[model samples]
Target: MSDQGNPDPTTMATDPTPSTTGPSARRRSLFKANGVPRSPREARASRIALDARERKRKREQLIMGKRFRSHFEDYEESDSEAEHEATPTEIQEINRGLAGSDEQVAKALKLLSARLVSPSAALEKFILAGECVPHLMRLIHSPNPEIQLQATWCLTNIAAGSEALCHKVLDAVPYLIQSLNPLNPDLADQAGWCLGNIAAEGPAFREHLVANGVVTPLVDLLTTSPNSQLTQTACFALSNLARNPGAPMQQLFDAGICGRLVKHLSQHESQDVASEVFWVLTYLTAGELQYAHRLVEQDVIPHLVAQLDKFADQGSAAIPLIRTLGNLSAIDDATTSRLLDHPEIIQQLLYWVAKSPARTVKKESLWVLSNITAGTKAHVNKVLKQDGAAVLTEVMSHDSYDLRREVSLGKREKLTGKMIRWVL
Candidate 1:
């Protein structure tokens, strides 16, 4: 009831008019213009219209997606929109502006960056048509570090698009790495970001990163810089480098990325930095045998365990860290022993298995346990020594269905039920 002691303004008005059936009057009246009671037909039509509008919206989104993909894939120079393509004279003018006063060059690069960041395929094609990529690289060498930074930023954005754009940006790698010197931390950070974009493409560009000598310099940035942000960005750059499945990884291992990343993991002072380093190591271990051997040889497992020990309570880094350890643990029987030798690591995995609310963490934890058990009998005893039997039983009875299935599947072999019974 309203304050006036009625059924609020929403109550039917006493006046039931027949011909004054406008929207508001209809809302107020209990009878329609025909003096009949309200019916569901009108409301039904409205709902149907809303449903049709929703379907139309979905169709439009699908068409937009197709356009984006088509634009990204169309690389033929002749097929590019001619109107967006700058004239040769205009291209020469922009080129001259790039070599003008340091400030003008910086502004020009910034302008290019702003345009590149736009979703306009026409603008991206225009830049490509003008063949301005090589010029952008030279701007990285300008006496002014700020100009170098803007150029690097532009390169990074241009490199972030599809393969066409990445190929264009790859020309700037040698100069990009040069700007990553410690003396200019800001320039170094942005340069690292740019290299990361270039590396994010497929194997061809990742190899370009290696061919242009990017790994060691990136590792240098991770090690030499005081800025956690820079280190994290460097880690990002390396992770992309390590992601390609068939890319040659020997050079990356030879660069000491293993020990560096492990050390970075232990420095859990910054969870963000530790997380990035953990991902880099994780990808490295997931690669070829040489990559896993190098990371394990660097004693990554201990640091991986230590990372869990340090940040387990935080709950953010625990799952990925455990997964990385589990991946490394599968290297071989000896690597499993290395993981078993670290009983605390087993306990850490058990802790997550039993406590983490995420089934993914619990599943990975159980998988790692299964890997450890698959080793020599001594390894099984190492985990059993840590009360893993009880942890498994608890997880089996966990309320989460996925967790229970994961644990059950992980222990499906001979040792599972027998191990549980033996421990009990």
Candidate 2:
């Protein structure tokens, strides 16, 4: 029985092939009875509907195009807006923060000391430049070593690189030097870094320091300070003193800084200290071959050779160590030849050339190899016969033109024309 709730109108109609008469055809027929459009009118209405849709789409495209252009041109304005947004509302705030009194400066110095490694570079710049040295000096007496340390670093950075700041820094030197004796590593490092900066500005300040007997305290620090940073900085300062072509160089020699530096070189655990010691020696021995024999006599070559391998594991040390060696080799031909004779050095270098991935180490290795082989045909033959030509040739092709010329000239003097031609 058919359910009365269910419409049986289609079943009663007895239409055959119900599946063939699709709903679309039926709806079209029903539309004709409902006063809808005829065939021609229906086609016209469809065209109108399609035209409306296309117009809507074009309007949307125009809106989107306008949006894109606005976005593109607004970049500069937006950037300016962002910059304005970041114009540091904190300047007036910092000034206000710093204004109250001596106690306020102390509090700011303490707060700044905590912010030394802050994510804010602005805060660091402000702390370094804006604070009065006197204020920092007051905080230096605070029971906190960190506050003293930060105050020292801020002063060093402010004074180190600027000649205009030298007098200002010199004014602060007594306090800074006093801070050097503090048992804190941070304070010691800042003091040493400041000294290096002063010496780096050239012979003027260096002579000033030496003439004032500052080198004695600095050298004594190198000897007694267990702090690596301080010792290294002291050595760097001494190097600058020795680097002076004036009376300060003689002063360093007289002060016995050279011997102390050599002793510092062998004993330090810090490669940085070792590297600077070598540099100090380099500066001392530079142009004057008189010290070359002394350096060799003191057996500096073996220690340098031992440190050559140290560069393999620590790549940053490689360039400085290699440069130091090159400078030493440039001191005199005999010392250069003596350093070349160390079997372990040559082997370690050759091994690095073969295995080390560091481009700097490889370049340094090539240079050290070239320096060792220079002025000695026997050594060149030993290197070339050991199949070092390919590496040397590669270095010649890849290095700077000046270096390439030096290498080529040095190689030519060592290898026979036939051997040189064969390599080239």
Candidate 3:
């Protein structure tokens, strides 16, 4: 139908040799390598598919972010609530967590010890409210060492401040006394701490503690485990029970607590232990004067005198022994004479009175001398000849006129030649 109609017919009729199939197939292979589907249906459908690794990573990040936000919000809420809602119920919840059987509570106890606000206050409230007594009792039996320790600590704090709590603690005394036998040092220490606090509140709960044979366990502990603090606390508890100063004193006297205590005091191991034992002796002697005489008859004075030669360091235990000696000397003539004649003790006392900078020890020295010489002319002369009067007169410079007049008159009344002549 064109000007070259004859030629067009010829070109149309020719098929033109099949185009090389290699390039088309190579193009298809390239598309497949790039993940472009060759099929129409596959290309039209979803082309991007997520792999397991990428999906898992996204999930983990999401979870981590959620956890972080949750904790952050919780911390903020806790802070805000602590300001206004630190009520009894809220406090109890926190205390329960602090004493929980979980490892979290164990961490909390350690954290609380280092914190400004003691978690123990909340614990005390729980105990006083009567809500957690059974829980606490059960917690004492927890398999976790830290939970048991914290529970014991909470009980100690509670018993220390509340009468009701002390009664509750009385119910648990047998259990605590049993815990004393635990082979662990820290556990035994905790038990000792609990008993100490209960005992410290005085003897209102004495019969409950003693009727259950509590002393035997504590005394038994001294034989095997001699933790200074534990032993000190035990001695203090025993002294509190014996505060009545009566025939019941024979109970402790019979247990031979005095001998053991003296033995501990005489040894220069730990100053704290020695100081506590010294204080216990002071309390025991002050209550019943015979106990002071009993100590002398048992040869405790010589050992005490022997300790005088061991000069105490900065926080010397010798000070306590000196004070106890002063008290015992005032209680009995036998102790007075024995102490006055102990050369080591006399020289140390004089030096401490005259030279030591501690006004307390210095004052105790003067007072000890006065107590020893109070009723006996021989003791008075011994002190006077030993230059005790000169030093005592010096103490007058530090005293009021009333005290000076008392000392001056006391010197005249006690320094008689008749008794001095007998001794010389």
Candidate 4:
């Protein structure tokens, strides 16, 4: 009799193959259509299926996992205690489910993705210890979009752990890159987020990302994605990729990322998006002088200057804008001259040095001034002409040692004897 009417496949007994006299026959005969196993073999099969069902139910309970939050923004590290500790047996079962049927794999991924949303170092360690990364990498190729998305999500969080744990997920980089298609923005967003976390690990991993050709698609997404969240996430990933001290700026420049970043900085309305774009520019400009010049060629300086007043009340946002200008100024007198070409840029820096409430803003502003003074004597005179000397004197007397140190450095840079007396 066919078992079509049985609601639970686990309890349905399959017809035994016809073997008139062997052990197969004996085992087959031991089970009834009613699913009452009359022998050890049938009983074991029943128990295994029941166990699988139970595990599936347990996994389903965790489907309502935590909502998605970008690791780049407000990511809090988990304490020593994990919110839900997984036992060795539980991890083993999850791993088994990963290798099980399609339904089981989906449920297992759901559970894994759910738990990883919060910062649970121990849980990540436990999962890694179970050797489940290969399974996750495999699932990234699953035709099922939900499973593919969940697998990517799990890896994203895993990459958010320590550098060692992130290394374990590196093999998924290629598969993650494949998911960057603009047609699937949600999956692309998750993949971009994962790549960002991996790139954030260090230089080698970033090289891995770039070597795998992660830049082209990321730039594509940044430029073409209609979904603002995906666009922002792509920007975040590119920023991390460019963050390396040994970053492959040539590859990024070849990919035309610098121009795109400037476009977003000038046109994107979201402060968060603009802030991340600034970071990308900041890191890129911090590299070889060519990158700073490329940004200038993109007409980035005037856009950056315009943002100073817009982000003035926002210290976090304002800091990067100041730092980017400072990086340009430090490049050389020619680049510094580009910034000085805008007279308000100097006035703005002096205003922040004297009046901005954030110590970091004042510090970065003074740092830019120091770079300016480090340039030709004309740059120093321009700063002094803007009342920069008085600002330095006031800052030098402040209680903040860091600010005073910055002022002292600025005072020492090419200041005339008259300017020195004014600051002193």
Which pairs clash in the backbone of model 3? none
The number of clashing residue pairs in model 1 is 0
lDDT ranking of the models = 4, 1, 3, 2
Tens-place lDDT per residue, model 3, 1-424, is 0100000101111001122221100111123444445576654332222124323433442221100000001122111211111235555455666556487565444332222112245545655674566666777788877677766665664564456666777777887888777366666756765665565454566666677766777666555665664665555455445544221466667677777877786664865565556656655666677776787777777777766655343323455567677777777666678777776666778777667766556655656665766657667767767776666666576765544443454443465654333222
Candidate 4 yields a Cα-based lDDT of: 0.68
Clashing pairs in 2: none
lDDT (0 to 1) per candidate = 0.62, 0.52, 0.53, 0.68
lDDT of 3: 0.53
Error of 4 at 170 (Å): 1.3
Q: Point out the worst 10-residue segment of candidate 2 by lDDT.
A: 1-10
In model 2, where do residues sit more than 4 Å from their true spots?
A: 1-103, 110-131, 137-147, 182-185, 239-247, 351-356, 396-403, 412-415, 422-424
Clashes of 3: 0
Ten contiguous residues with the weakest lDDT in model 4? 1-10
TM-score of 4: 0.75
* lDDT of candidate 2 at residue 423, scale 0 to 100: 36
Per-residue CA lDDT of model 2 for 1-424, tens digit only, reads: 0000001100111111122221111112223434345576664564466446444533442221110000001122111110101114544343454455556654544333323212144543454475545565665566655555555654554443345444456656666566566366556656765665565555677666665566667667766788665676666556555553553655555566766766766776666677667656656655366565566677777777777665566653455556657667666566667766776666766666666777656666666676766656666666665667766676566656654554565454555675466434
Q: What lDDT does candidate 4 reach at residue 121? A: 51
For model 1, residues 50-120, the per-residue Cα lDDT tens digits are: 44643453344222111010011112322122112233444455567787887678556644654443325
RMSD of 1: 17.0
